[model samples]
Target: MTSPVPSVDLRLVDLLRHDLTAADFTVPGVEAVVGPTAAAALHREQDVPARRAVAAVLRAVADPAAVLTALWVLGEDVTRRQVDAALPGLGADGAVALGLVEASGQGADDAVRAAVDLRPYAAQDAVGEVTWWLASDLSELQTGRRLAADHVLGAGGASLTLAQVTMRDPRGRVLDLGTGCGIQALHAARHAGSVVATDISRRALAFAAFNAALDQPDAVTALDLREGSMLEPVTGERFDLVVSNPPFVITPRTGAAGGGASGLPDYEYRDGGRAGDDLVRDLVVGLGEVLEPGGVAQLLGNWEHRRGEPWTERVGSWLDAAGLDGWVVQREVLDPAEYAETWLRDGGSTSDRDPAVWADAYGAWLDDFASRDVEAVGFGIVTLRRPDPAAAPAGRVTLRRLEEHTGSVRQPLGAHLAAVLAAHDRLQGLDDDALAAQRLVVAPDVTEERYLTPGAADPNVVLLRQGDGLGRAVHASTSLAALTGASDGELTVGQITGAIAALFDVSATDLAAELLPAVRGLVTDGFLLLPQ
Candidate 1:
């Protein structure tokens, strides 16, 4: 049976925190001790090199930090002496009392084994950088088996992605839906006056509560922890910001994936026990009800793409039904077979290790996709905002954008995204005439690249590239390039257009008509900014 989540006791947790801090078991500390090669290997879940590295470190010196890394991170057993020395404040007894470890025997000779996975996590956002020790259920590395359905996850790639993308602007109230291990809630608590973290699984809540208490006791103690799936727990309440990394993984409904003898394991951490991608669809459409006017909801999700229908149409339909301003960035699209293999391997089933089970699971996934005529699966980040009824255009939700951006993007995109939304609002209120009268400046992060053939008199192609934000690259026409080159905040857009039209011997009215739309695009995408 799976071990119970770590017990949450304030005083005991404080002692653990002291030990963790004193040992310097932070991200940099761990990286420094393990070095680059082992650290990289650990990320790949290959423990051999990391174990060897930790062993080498221990041999050279009896380092408490190395001992802790070996014991907690590498999932290796530590002697009682090492545990007592490393966590002198929380001793072996205190660790056992806190349910963080199990002591096998009495005295210094006894071996101590970690009952949970604890590691230091460091992150930077709009506010600043923070370091916290996160504790969750031991992974397959420790247990050497597939994770239990109710396993609570620690900081993974998805969690970090959601954290980096989340808007860190201070708000009155925040909601973290599906708060697995409460990572988002912790980040939300940094800026939000108050936070409510809800999850469907009690085990997950327990882990979240423990992690909160362990890291930000004062800040998270006031965090409202509720048990319910999705928005049910926070019904009727509203928030300024809502963030979720929901269980949006698509899974086959039946046990055919397990050779019909045992069906697909519905891991609560990743699967919502719903058919297809209905959970994501429902959340997108329903989450707006709990948002205050002008509130924003950021979430990560997966959507199915049926044959003959573009992914934009499918996701766009969700935004249409949502009745809110939304921007969907399709970060990746995988074919049915690739999607099946990726998720199957995630569940610890591999074709090389178990061909029969792999084949069965693969077939089940393909069959499910066939039933829905799903040709591909798309995954992306979703940002939704409830338009303030007073400020929004009458009877219209104007911000509905579904675009593909699979390339790299700047980290801590909160400021850029908030600016983009504000820019959109400003542009929506301006007519072409009003816009042309406004002065514009090219953003500092933007640069123009001229692509010219060898020995060419002039560049045939010009590209405007943004070094930050979405890392957008916009193709520029000769006239457009000249117009941007002249936009130095000293002249109105109309003035620049007139000058460009004179140089090209074209009508000023036609030039504005051609450049205004592109100018609007540039402003909306952060390539250009209105003068302050």
Candidate 2:
């Protein structure tokens, strides 16, 4: 039987916190006990090495950290004495009461096993580095079975990815839609005056509440936990910022191939129970209703790339429908087979373990794709901002930029995003003449590279590369290169372009017209900065 969802017993949770802190069952502490080899192996989802590593530590020393790692993290059975030692404040009985563990027998020799997956998570964002204890349903490694439909996910790669990219600017109110374990809400609480965390799963809300109270009590007090699907709970409200890592995984509809009698595996943590990417589409288009003017929403999503239709057009249409200023950075693309294998393995359906089940699910996935004429799947980070009504354009030029940047980008991109948005707004207010009069400076992170033919004097290519933000590389024309090289906050763009025009024997008007667009692109992308 599936274990009961954990209760939010503040008293017991406080005691558990005290014990956890005392035992130093933190990220660093666990790494120390498991050693680097086991730690690295565990990160790859291999537990044997971590188990052996922790076991060796326990044999040599009766350490609380080792005991906790072996019992909770490694999912190994520990004696009553070990459990008592690890959680002295919250004894074995207290742990069982909180639904964190279960005892098999009354004797000390009897083994006690963890009922949930609890681990320490540490991360650094705009707010700074923070450590928190996160609780969720145990994984296949712990339960030795496939996951339940409504599994509350812990801090996985996607969670951290969304967290790192979230804009941490201060806001009056923030919303965390589809908050799995409340990680995004926790991050939002750092900067948001008030945070509302909502989820479709009641069980997920319980975990979110528990984690919030345990990790951020002050922030949790301001958190409003509501249970509902999508935006139903906060229908009429508006927020300054909204962040979500929604159940955007595209799953097949019922009776479709691989869908089985149950249709798709309705994992509340991933699948939105909607047909073929509709969940993502609906969220993107409907977000405008809940966003206050000038508000911003950041999300991670996957969209289907249908045959003969570009991914940009499909996503761009959503942006146009919403009428919000939007930018999408496609990070990766996977074909139908690769996509099926990934999600299948993610849900613990592997060919080696169950070839027949895998085959059926695989066929269903392919059939679903065939029905939709989907050639591939595209995944990316999407940033949307509601244009401020006061500064709204007469023609309302929506920023519909769809670019691919799969390469490495600077972490904690919140500040960069804010800068880009600010720059865009500033540029919007300036006409060509006004823009030319403004002084400009090259950003510190930008570098220029020139490549020349082996024995030739004149360079054949000039590239301006950004070392931060999206890490963009732009090809620069001779005149534009000269303009950027001289941009030191000391010369107006008009004067620089005039000098370049004279040097190249070109009309100043023609040269400015040619380079103005490139200049605007550089500034918006963080390669150039408008003088303060």
**The best candidate in terms of TM-score:** 1
Residue pairs in collision within model 2: 257-364, 258-364
lDDT of 2 at 291: 95
* Model 1 accuracy (lDDT, Cα): 0.89
lDDT of 2 by residue, 1-532 (tens): 4567778888998999999999999999999998899888888998998888888888898899999888878788999998988889998989899988889987987889998898999987766788989998998877677787888889998898889888887899999999988999999999989999999999998889989888887667999999999999999999999999999887766543334653335688998888888989999999999999889999999999999999999999999999999999999999999998889888877523766777777888888889999999999999998888677755374577999888998877778888998898888888899989989999999999999999999889999999988788999998899999999999999999999999989899999999999999998888889977
lDDT of residue 287 for candidate 2: 96
Assess candidate 2 and give its TM-score to the true structure.
0.96
Q: Against the true structure, candidate 2 has what lDDT?
A: 0.88
Candidate 2 positional error at 290, Å: 0.7
Q: What lDDT does each candidate get? A: 0.89, 0.88
Tens digits of per-residue lDDT for model 1 on 205-267?
A: 898899999889888666999999899999899999999999999998876663256545678
**Candidate number of the best lDDT:** 1
Worst 10 residues of 2 by lDDT: 255-264
lDDT of 2 at 341: 82
Runs in model 2 lying further than 4 Å from the true structure? 255-264, 394-397
lDDT of 2 at 320: 92
10 residues in a row with least lDDT, candidate 1: 255-264
